[model samples]
Target: MADSLRESAVGQLLRLVNRQWLPYPDERPEFQLPDYDTPIDQEKPADHISSIGPDHQPKRRSEGEEQDVEAFQLAKTATAERTVSRTLTPIRTSDGIVLVDWYTLDDPENPHNWSSPKKLLVSFEICMYSFAVYFGSSVYTSSIDGIIERSGVGVVTASLGFALYVLAYGIGPMLWSPLSEIPSIGRNSIYIATFSIYVLLCIPEALVDNFAGLMVLRFLLGFFGSPCLATGAATFQDMYAMIKMPYLLAFWAGAVTLGPALAPVVAGFSVVAKSWHWFAWEMLWLSGPIWLLMLFLLPETSAPNILLRRARRLRYLTSKAQLKSQSEIDQAHMSAREVAFDALIKPWQINALDPAVLFSTVYTALVYGIFNSFFESFPLVYPIIYDFNLGESNSVFLSVIVALMIAMPTYCFYYYYWVEPKVAKHGFGPPEQRLIPALFACFLVPVGLFIFAWTTRSSVHWIVSIIGVLLDIPQFAASLFAANDFARSSVACGCILFAHPMFVSIGVPGGISLLGGLTILCAGGLYILYFFGANLRARSKFAAK
Candidate 1:
């Protein structure tokens, strides 16, 4: 009885950690075969082995892949037209390996097959997770004055705590994102573990008095909190249909936008009500519960990880040494040289060699850097010119979130009415079709900045400048995959490091107008890409043909 109790406790703990909703594949009666041994002789494992190249991994089929074209087409016709691609039949591969796959089209174990309510639950959880981390990034900005006064540091030195935090998270995904891709480690483990560390680090950050200690702790906080920022959309893609993705992603992107937008309001009031230490504590208050909720409910979402665990269970049950998932097979054959190149070199190569990638990276980095600059710029404008208190001054940031609310729904409407039908009829649209939204947004940014630049006087109504801030939210495809997360983020970090100093040197009017002019140039770049991007992609080796 005591042993059973102990075992029950251990099983519960495992369930909480893994949070995979279905039974282990080995434990299911359908998976157990009375005639399992009879089929063993008929399996031609060598044929499967010879088909795969040494360096080839089982990648998610791209739109360019022949086999996936029909699937993509079928996905658009109707809900009734959708069909499952993989089945329960064990595929024997090279070296006596049994490959594990979904039981059927409706297999609940497959994340894609999960019910709508369940998918929404997971989506909401991840969105909250993303919001908490991004909220941490700017919460410190409201407390910068407190830090400067207490530590006797200059404005720039105090702001480094915020700037370095941004840089650290950008650097972090280079390491953490790769670990999440490993089938055995998976997304949930990376998210929960790192977020736990992030939440705990907030305690130290809140308590630390020294400038150097505070800087280090802030950087650590951002580093540990980064996985969600980089991978949250990838999680959305794992379950949602491609046709349905823009709608869901619009919401996810809104969450990202609102995080920093809302941060100042909370931290601003908290700092004024109590001490600056409350800014750090507020992160814990926001994030600690989020971590607990994630621990209990956030299931492992990576399809590779789910199948890999299933393969392990099947191997143990059948007493077979070679039962594996495709991910496991790929992992086994991957060489150290390939790993290093994929992790370190490939993103830079694509960014450098592909014009489309370079354009998107530069455009998005400028947008983010300017957005980050607002954290510094807002206090300068509102408190000095408008005579608003810290909390009220910080509240101007609500305009960004207001803009986000408007922009997301607007994008969804455009995708549904404009983009979706064309894609449905044509199989998939050209890459330039994705840039249509950007064409509008790129032009809007310069207009918004110019309005903001000219309207900084007390004689001007604050709402006009706030309206300009509202319109400054630019839409672009951000780096979503684990492979390129670091590349995009690093560039954004560099821009962020430069943004504050540029604003300080030129003053807000000069600085804002300069950014406005830059966006006008970027707007011209967008127009060029819209017309010429296809030709650029055709010439590039990295781009899809």
Candidate 2:
């Protein structure tokens, strides 16, 4: 039965890939332009073929044999509207024909309407930005011992810096996400500005002489660097349709997961070869060019922002007072304080009150806290139990990356072939469908934790403990992805806030056992969501909006 299932899954995945590359044999032909070079009277209007009568005869043209210019223009406009109306918003032209809003259908400024290559390039850059910042967060873990030795702080105290940085980014997004969404400011501008400050803060973090200075700088670094984490997913909503979201988001989630997992490998080498401060230098060198690429190549993606620019240009040239984007018109009456409160404070209240958000927050928080605890526990378990060097100790994290590689494709296959087909058949089902991968993840989390907990004994092989760690990676990835997809951004902040205190109360081993138990409890919550999520969404005023 298992082998059969595996083969079926593989076949489904192949079909999915094939479909992406080549259309089905019976698919309708795409729209083609008419040969306008020939005089209007000499050529047949082939554009009207698709709109022919049921008898398979061409419809009579509104113009007689003289070839009416207005009739030809109307036919061309109608054809364009039919081709793009599903994806782009249509606005009536002065000639009584429709074109896409702000600009024509093929406008490069509209992120959603951009070419696939352009969208992929932007997604790649944003994922790189996310990877760089998250890498900085965990690279510090390998340097914890160096930090303790140099600053005369205990392991617990040094660990606080990591905890605080995580907490800061979680909270920082509440402030930054709102700012980034403003039509005048926009996604790319916030990315460039905050990221520049974030990189500059790293220098002081490396050079700081005291523990207090280190903590302060680390907190600021996370705070300034948070836009990538907070608003990165929102960029996808701007760029892709719902059907393509899962795959693109999986790529993004992979990059986010890889950053921390890959960090320790590099940091371990840096610590042994040079010093802990070298990790900081490494981050600086790596992140600088990413920032530059974003500044130069990443365009403004927010639709309101693009339209606002167009509105401004139209107002300048034509002096029309009524020409304004929906965002501008909506914000015209509200003060900045009102806008901020609605954007920032309202989301928090909704997240707090909503059952879906609360459950997702708890699950994501537990996963995040456990992942952080690994940094503290690994040194104790790997080096002391297995007698491995720093590099080998760090290489254990590669297992997490391997697990992620396996998990993402498997989830993609299941999602595309199984869940997506159901959704397509039924129309968008409950948000709980997003949690399907996460449900299995809940069981895996505990299974991995228990394995790690028992296998860390001196007699046990180190690979057993590594396997335990490996099991948690897919769960972590799945849970984070589900929560981000299903719950509000405020849930991310709540998870981070909750993670800091959890990590502080229990050291690594105790934390692992606690997380294992919590996973079982969270799994029950997932079951509730799976069964009742649609009903809850039905009752939610916020979900209605």
Candidate 3:
């Protein structure tokens, strides 16, 4: 094939026909033209054939003449005369270069062949950094009451400490995601730098004497730390191969589910043993060393960064002289600036304008709102009822921890291994698989809510009340995972997925906190209602009814 392509007269003519616009395919194999404007190489255009001469000179004036002319044309321009001008070769793009893969896989630079240690390293780092961001968001659960008393801020204003952090969670990822697209600012660096800023921001909350200062610092910390939570999944998607993606996502999803569970435990110590100010101080102290360790241990997990390094190193090892620098590589297909802009705007815009995006965002956010609200309500619910001591206030969260350990794995098995495959087999988009987790959540959330709520009493044995609380965990975790899958699959860039927790954290409490007077009864009823609504929606989608 190579000799025929190289030596054929037709091949030489084809090369001559394209001129310098198409480079020699065997060596400098690039088309020096825009992607859309590049000449179609797959076939000869009818007009082109005519212009080039005999290939498609058409027929004659009459039937006999037409047949004779066709035969002559076919004879004159046989495949033997023509040769494929451009040789098949692969090139890299800035996107692919940084990611250590060819934008086109046949390039041999694909990351799929990366060592197992490297892939595992990237996955672990994503999990921990994601965990760190969640920690910043909810770690203050124990300190809210104390901060209010010491700072003299009203409950509504102080809640902003956490609210603003979560708000950043929504807002931060939007910008940071684009920022990470830059080959220079690796995702690992982004995690380290922003998380470091987060810890410092917390210091003021611990040390500051004024409410204004606390709010300002809290917001600042969140503003800086926002990317960790916001960009986690995208980071995950970029690293793991497709086959491992679901299970990897499941593991990270577990961290996300578990982050809140462990938060109360951290806060419990702060509230039970120390001043709220000191608690802040302690968290600040703790975050610094942890971040330092993360910085030292977590390598750059961003695909682009990995590729950029590999491309640079490979350039040195081989004689492939035209190894274009990262920016120079993909600029033909998309400039860094253009790529970043699209990455930033497309997700939010699609969610607002596209029904699938909006529906997924709305459903997941609503369900997630229910789950996260449970996290936000610790101070109010725990302190008042059960007359629980400081640490005991955080005990309510234990139910969640226990339940998630059970529920998350079960949902994992059902989604990645079962429902998802069924969806694929049936021609449903990945979002369709999300609907199944909804079934699990719908069944579990209400049952736990009613059990926990009605079971609550000074005399009914706190463990029984705790059981209801415990059951709520898996239900929420399962629902949350489902909602996330839907949001990610439906939204462009999975950007709306970024809002899942933000919307949930605020929405759940915004409604549920109002009904703490009937906490168990109301919560149970609400979970059941949402789950029921979710199931109906899922069935409707499946049945297309």
Please give, for residues 370-397, the per-residue lDDT of candidate 2 as tens digits: 5555445677667777888888899988
lDDT of 2 at 444: 81
Model 2 C-alpha RMSD to native: 12.6
Q: For model 2, where is the 10-residue window of minimal lDDT? A: 1-10
lDDT of 3 by residue, 1-545 (tens): 33223222334345467633222332343423212222333232221111111222222234543554344334322322322222222322222221122333222223343345555765776676666666666676577778778777665566666666655556666667777877756676677678877877776677787777776776677678667556666666665534346677767777666665677677777666767765576557656776755654554555556556545544544434444443335444666577866876666665554545455566555555555554544454455556877677776666656676776677667766775566445744444444555544555556655555455545667687567667666545533343233242232112222332442455433334332333344344444444464454444432352
Point to the candidate with the largest TM-score.
1
Error of 1 at 358 (Å): 2.1
TM-score of every prediction relative to native: 0.87, 0.77, 0.66
Question: Per-residue lDDT for 162 in model 3?
Answer: 67
| Stretches > 4 Å off in candidate 1 | 1-12, 15-36, 40-77, 80-87, 474-504, 543-545
Mark the regions of model 3 whose C-alpha exceeds 4 Å error after superposition.
1-111, 310-321, 325-327, 332-341, 415-430, 478-545
lDDT value, residue 341 of candidate 1: 83
Candidate 2 segments whose C-alpha is farther than 4 A from its true place: 1-100, 481-511, 538-545
Model 1, residue 332: distance off in Å is 2.0
Candidate 1 global CA lDDT score = 0.72
As a whole number from 0 to 100, the lDDT of residue 379 in candidate 3 is: 50
User: Whose lDDT is higher: candidate 1's or candidate 2's?
Assistant: 1
